[model samples]
Every structure is written in C-alpha cells, then in structure tokens.
Target: MNVPAAPHSVQPVRLRISYRSPESLLQAFTKSVGKGGVSLPSQRPLARGTRFLFELTAEAVAHPVEVLGEVVDVRRSASGEYFLNIKYVPGRSRKGLDAALLKLFEAHRHEKSRRYPRVPVHLKAQGTTQVWSVRDLSRGGAGVELETGELPKDARLGVPVLLELQLDTGRLMLHGAAVWLTGGTSRPKTPPALGVEFGRLGLETLRALDRVLVLDGFPAGPWQAELTFGMDAVGRMP
Candidate 1:
C-alpha cells in the first residue's frame, strides 16, 4: 500500500517597511504590531481608551499603511504640546508588521556600522537660481538649509535636483534628489532643510567631492560597505 503524503505548511506573509530613521521605525512597529503605542504631538484632547486609525506614509514605500490604535495615556509638554500615547490593536496585520520591524531594525544596525560619516560644512550652493546653505556633507548625501519658502513649488520626495557648489578647487554640479525634510510644525528645533541623496557619480565628480571631503577632515578612503540593506528592506515590504 502507498503511504499518504504529508501536507505542506503555509507560510505567513511578511510586511516590508522602507528604511528611514530609527525613531520612525520604532513608531511604525509600535503602531503596526499593537504591543505598544507611539506618542503624537497634538493639541486635541483624547480620552483614555479612545480608538483611532493612523496612516503611515513614506517615500520608499509605494502605498500608505493604516494602523488601528487605542489611546493609552495623555500628557502635556512644557512647550504646551499635547501628547497621546497609543496602543495598537491586535489584527491580521500583526504578523507582517512584526516581520517588517525586525528587518528594519537589522538594517538599521548594519547602516550604523557601514554608512559614510558626515562632516560639518558651511558651503553655499545654487539650485535653479535659488541659493541654499549646505550644513553637512558625506559621500552619500548632504544636508542643506532652505530659506523661508525657498523650497520649490514642485519639489517633493524623490524629486530630481541639480545643485552647483563653489568648492575651493572649482565649481561642481551635483545631481541628486530630495530624500528627507525637516522643519515646519513637525520639527521646530530643526530649521527648514532638505536631505539630498546624490545620484551615480562620474569619475570627475567623485574625485572632486573626495578632495573636498578630505580637506574637510574626512579620512581619504572608501566606506566599508554599501547601503544595500536599507534599499533591500523596501522591496521586501508587502
């Protein structure tokens, strides 16, 4: 007699989260997994145990993720900002959320170890007739400050931009895209600024940037590893 074959076990789906900051990753995990809650800055008062829904959006991710949460606690900051601590509700999305958080955390650890270090700078750059101040620079990107309403009307995450910098050696034009933004009501402590991630660099531009960085006290050498984990994490998200 033929023996019966064993049934295959079905694997659960995993959630993919785009790489951002550790703080953002933590908040996403707490909101998605429902084990803990994230604090939000709001002026509106919410009673304990009040349920609500929050949408999480990111540039790397294609679509927004919705999470259900219940208010756990409330407090007022010295700056008069009201904060609400929320706890996530258990749901079908929990499994994917857990997996995504784990992957993001792992990616974060690798990023901290392999990423290029940034050096402080006070360089001026011109972008499409607009002037900006470069606050920090690294092999991967630069942090630039924008004056009041200096951001382009069409500028958004991942929008291509060309910046011309006046270096001691010569003027260099760098092609990049806006990766992050800070300021406004979200981040009062940080002045309005944009994080620009440079695109594939030509030999001439690389040499020029390296020369500038070396003079700014960055050791003249290549970073250990590429930032692949962060990018890979985005693809793995569901």
Candidate 2:
C-alpha cells in the first residue's frame, strides 16, 4: 500500500493597515501568525512571548481598533530590515483597532468628497521641522504638490506631519522619521524626492489608506511600500 503525504498548510491571510500617531499615519501590509517576539533596537531585545500594546490615536482612536498583539515571529528580511510577525489576542483590543480604522475610513471618505489632496514629490533640503502638502496619495507613495510658501526643509516620508484621511482612519500621534526623497528625470545635480516606508500599521488602518487611494481616482489595486535603507547587522539604538 502507498503511504499518503501530509497535507499542505495555507498561509494566513494578510490584512493591510494604516495606523496613525499624533504626527502621521502609516500604511502597512501584513499577515498575523504565531506568538512572542524579539527586537533589534539598541541594548534591548523584548523578551520572547512578551505581549505589547499599540495605541492608535485621533481617527484611529476614534475608531474601534487598537493593535494588541503578542510577537510570534522575529527574523530579518533579506535586505536586513527586522521582520516581526504577531498574533493579536482578540477582545477589547480588537475592538479598539476596529474603531480606530473605521474613523480613519470616515475621514478618507470626507477628504475624497471634496478635492483630492496632493503630497509633495520632492524636496531640495532637510531643514528642522519640514512640511509639505500631499497632492495625491497611493498605497506605495504620494505625489506631493509642493508650494513655495509651504516648502519642507526636512521633507521626509517617515517624518511626522499632520496627516488625515476620510472614513475611519485614525490620527497619527508618535514618531515619523525620514525615509527618502523622490527622483524623477534627474538633472546632473538634483536627486529625486524622498521616499519613506512605514514599518507598522494596524490591519484596519491599512484598509483606510487603500480606500482613500481608490477614492482619489487610483484604480483599486495592490500597492507595495518601497524603501532604500537596509541594516546588515542589528544594533542597539543607544
């Protein structure tokens, strides 16, 4: 008699999220899996299986979603970025996350109703406290429409800025850092504008950004976040 082979398991479904801090909303895509985690931050690695909390603010807070999860998988991507997978224990936390995302979506809906906002595509310099207007935004990046009066000295992607979306999206509250500037048909001297990639987003939050992109007249499609930086060896922040 022939022996039977083991059945193949399916990969868990990945939900996209757009999470907000006081400063900016982050767009991210991820799938939930397993338990416990480790961190690459300076001098400290979170104990494995430790539970952590992610608080969504503004629209995120208004909605029902909050990121409450336990780290399950901790590894580094090929490009050297730390990869963390988590499984959120459902209950009150799940509701919080849901609420937060709903609010952001509501904001997105309102924003789309009037005029589609534009994001700055490029910046010449990185001064303290940079800012810009979003011309059009998509899942991956936004084409920023810069104004002379509103030029960003420190224009960056991950940098904190007041961001909003219609529908149930949440308000960004915490950290935003510089990721990159874009590059178009380049002059001999000028490089492209900056590009930033978000590391974290709640599942519902990601959904709000997707809805906004579609409302902004982008054909509904999957968009991937892109970044240029890669760390070879994990190091402490201090």
Candidate 3:
C-alpha cells in the first residue's frame, strides 16, 4: 500500500543536493524546494518510494545540510528531462538549517552565492613523480593525503608541487605550494595529510578546474558527473 505524500510549498531559494552512493556521492540540483519536499532533476528516474539520505548545499552556508527523503513522484519534463519529487523525512535537528534559511530569505536576500564551492573529490596529486590522494578540492586548493612512506621529512613549508587531475573531460595540471601538513602513521591521525594552495594557473587549466568543480555541484550546471568507486582514477586513498 502507498501512503499519501505530505504537502509542501515552493521555496524561493534553490539548493544543490548530494546523494549517497555505494561507490561515492552523486549530485543533483533542486528545481524547487520546501520544508516538506523538493523536486530534483535527474538523468535516470529514481524508483518510487525509494528512500535515501542526501546533503543539501545552499548559498552562504558553510556546511552541507543533511536530509532524509523518499521519492514520492517521478515525472518526465517537456524537455525530456526526468524530475524526481522527494518528500522530506525528519532525521537531524533542522533548527539550525531553518534559522540559516530564514536569514537567507529575510536579511541576506541580496547576498551573492559563492562563486567557488568546495567539493569532496578524489583526485591524484603528483609532485616530482610522487603520487598522493587529493581527498577534497576547491578551485583554489585541495586537501591531499600522503602515505607514511611518501611524506618527506626534509620538505619545508611552501614547497612547490604539481597536481594532475584525471577528470572525465581530460587531464588538468596545476601548480601549488604546500601550505600546511598534518597526520602521519605515528602521528595523531591515521594517514598523513597536506594542504596544498594552488598558485596561478593557465586560462585553460583554470577553466578545466572550474568544469570539474561544476560537475561536483559547484554552482550546479548540466555536466557529465558521476561517482567513481575505485581510487585508481584518483590515486591511492585509504
């Protein structure tokens, strides 16, 4: 038996959603959203009544807002795109989210959305032919993880390195400097990590980075974005 979906109103603001996948995270953008539901565009129509967890990204919000929902409706748009209507379910406390949203609707209505949204991506970082795992990325920099054997003890701060991102479109190479380091095999954390701040890149390289970021819900656009399961495409990551 099927239950009636809870009613909802359309919100003025739009948001991006990242759904959980067995491999990694898949992203989508909302056509319309509300306290009780949201409509998302999808290439593949999700199954009706299929429940899933997703993180919502909104303008000026520093962290991803968590939500749980089930697909209540699936319809094909006039333009041949698939629209999935999901009904929100209570999970985490929405007090903080509601407050932030209210502020966006009221006070900061004119605030511009972030031009460069950070994303959780796994890309390979190669410096001097040595490889590392770039776990998180933005247009400006990335957080890379280096294995115990790879972290050079003699390397000083601001050491220059090059990152080669194997994106679906093509290979993107950018130069950067090591701004910070943390973790190690014997250190407090599990794997060693480095914060690489990207230096100036060529016009083409910058465009490529922007393209990759857009695929990951950075500014939300139509792109060939999908989740990758193995780290081989993104370098060795634990």
Candidate 4:
C-alpha cells in the first residue's frame, strides 16, 4: 500500500531572508515557503531539527515578517548550494507576528512615510568617548555609525552595553546589544555601522521614543525585542 502525502497548510511564497542570531545577521533567499514549511538556500546549513528566528523581507512588502522556524530537511542544489527545509512553529509569538505583518501590508498601500526622525548627537561607549550619528530610533533599537576600529575588538553579538543619548527632551540612558553590523567597502568608502536593539528600556523612555516614531506618521512594525540572536562566527566588526 502507498501512503498519502502531507497537505500543504499555507500558500508558497518566495522571499528574501535575513537570518539573525547571536553570531550575526546573514542574507539568503527562499526557494519556496508555506504555512507548513519553507525551503531556503543557505551557505551555512544547520543540522536537522535546529530552530531559529529570521526576518522575511520582500520587494513589495513594506516590513519584514518575523518567523521562528525549525530545520526539517536538507538538500543540495545543482549549483552546490545548501538548501534547508524549515517548518514554522506557532506559539504565543506567532499571533503578534501575524498581526504585525498584516499592519505592514495595510501601510504599504498608503503613501510612503519618512524613515524616522534622526538628529546629530555625541555619545560614548566603552572607556573612550566619541561622537556618533544615530538614526532609525525606535523603542526597540537604533543604528549608530562606526568608523574603522570604532567598535571594540572584543564586542560581540548580544553583549549588553550602556549607551547615553542626548535627546532634545533631555539626556537618556539606554541598554542594548549589538545585533547587526555592516559597511566598510570600496563602493561606499565610508565607515561601517552597528545596529543596537534595546533590552532594558524603561516605561518613561519608551514613551519618549514613541513620540519620536509615531508622531511623524511612521507606521510601527515588529521590533527586535521579540527575537533572539544565535552565535555564528563572522569576520571582525566593520
């Protein structure tokens, strides 16, 4: 007797994938995706049953969709690329993620809004103090410019550090972890930068950030606090 195949739960989609873990955030592409599972081409394939979080960004989509997936199968492409099959795992987090994706779809139908209100400010980290330009501020995270060797050689993903910001309202203290770093190439000829996601934001501080984000007609989407970074070895911070 022959056995029947499992049913497909969700429609298949092809999306650009940004895999985030404590080690670093790397880019990849999906071959096929559905509510039940997804197939992606990856340079670093994980062992079967390994679970991780990633953001699916698409050209037509305004914001990336966050999903927690577990590796179920692995395959090799004709071009010698590794293809990993990932099954979606739903829990308390799935509901919020679904809602956020829906909101992004709605916002995409409207006029494009400003990225976020940013201003020049001097801030210090480590024992040495220096001025850094900050932007894309949210209750969850912000981006900071990093010149050559600006990031501590010892700094790694998910390492918490205290940062001081000089907002127009007043001075504020923030605790965040290094999530993503990019740049330092000939094309740009500019310094690289680090992406910091807030970990211990106070109630008052959140309100202050909300004013800066929502007041200017920026539609809120998923933030980094809901995800975890995994450790993957990468080159030095740029």
Q: Pick by TM-score: which candidate is best? A: 3
Better of 1 and 4 by lDDT: 1
Q: List the residue pairs that clash in candidate 3.
A: none
Per-residue lDDT of 1-238 in model 2, one digit per residue for the tens?
Answer: 1111222223222222344441133232111211112232212223335454444444436442344555565666565554455456442234543444444445656574434233311211222343333433545444433333333444545554323332323332111234556543443244334433333556665666655543321221221122111220012111
Superposing every Cα of model 4 onto the true structure, what RMSD results? 17.6
The predicted structure with the larger lDDT, 3 or 4, is 3
Model 4 gets an lDDT of 0.46
Per-residue C-alpha lDDT of model 1 across residues 1-238, encoded as one tens digit per residue: 1111222223211223453643354344332342235666666556676665544444443334545666678788898767877665544243333443344445545565537655444554544445566666667888777665445554567766555554545556566777987775566666678887888888888888876553321221111111111333233222
**Arrange candidates by lDDT, highest first: which order?**
1, 3, 4, 2
lDDT of each residue in 1-238, candidate 4, tens digit only: 1111222334222333543421111112111222246666776555776665556644444455555666688788888777777776653133433333344335545635634333222222322334344534556677666544454453456665445543446545666688877665633665667777777677897776665443221122111111112221112111
Question: Against the true structure, candidate 2 has what lDDT?
Answer: 0.36
What's model 3's overall lDDT?
A: 0.52
TM-scores vs. true structure, each candidate: 0.40, 0.29, 0.41, 0.35
Residue-level lDDT for 153 in candidate 3: 53
Report the number of backbone clashes for model 2.
87
TM-score of 2: 0.29
| Superposed Cα deviation of residue 156, candidate 4 (Å) | 2.4
